[model samples]
Target: MAPEMISIHGGVFRMGSDRFYPEEGPVHEVAVEPFELDATPVTVAQFAAFVDATGYVTTAERP
Candidate 1:
């Protein structure tokens, strides 16, 4: 079975931080559109199963 996804309503909000990193600063206003997101986070075992089925190799696996 596939995982469920939830719809997120879009809105305007202040983004970024001005105190932490110099590149992240200047908190600016941004608008976002509705989007769908996974209802739950992926589990390590699920990822392992995907890798096994697809023979996928992560960057960490490479030298």
Candidate 2:
């Protein structure tokens, strides 16, 4: 099955929480350009299948 995908429009959105962990503190607005993302998490098996079928190498695998 194909993975579901979503399109994100360019905009600024508040991220992180000031009341949470220290690392997550200082809540701020982040600007992002348009992008695409998978609507749901991809499984390892599914990822492997796609890579194998496409003979694709991930950036991490590069020497």
Candidate 3:
């Protein structure tokens, strides 16, 4: 199926995991420019297609 284009407005957000990780701390706010995020997690079919197209091996395949 052909992909559809979507428009989204930009906004500021506090991004972090709320963990001891120093980078994640401070809970600082950020102004993120408009961009597209995947609407959902990758499906099995999508993963298969990626592996097939690139013959891309994942770390799991390594001992």
Best by lDDT: 1
Q: How accurate locally is residue 28 in candidate 3, as Cα lDDT from 0 to 100?
A: 79
Candidates in descending TM-score order? 1, 2, 3
Tens digit of per-residue lDDT, candidate 1, span 4-37: 9999999999999988999997899999999998
Model 3 residue 58 lDDT? 92
Return the top candidate by TM-score.
Answer: 1
Predictions: Cα RMSD each: 4.1, 3.9, 4.9
Query: Is 1 or 3 the stronger prediction by lDDT?
Result: 1
Error of 3 at 19 (Å): 8.6
Q: If both were scored by TM-score, which would come out higher, candidate 1 or candidate 3? A: 1
| Candidates sorted on lDDT, descending | 1, 2, 3
For model 2, the run of ten residues with the poorest summed lDDT: 1-10
Q: Candidate 2 vs candidate 3: which has greater lDDT?
A: 2
TM-score for each of the candidates: 0.58, 0.54, 0.44
- lDDT at position 11, candidate 1: 97
Q: In candidate 2, residue 13 scores what lDDT?
A: 94
Error of 3 at 7 (Å): 3.5
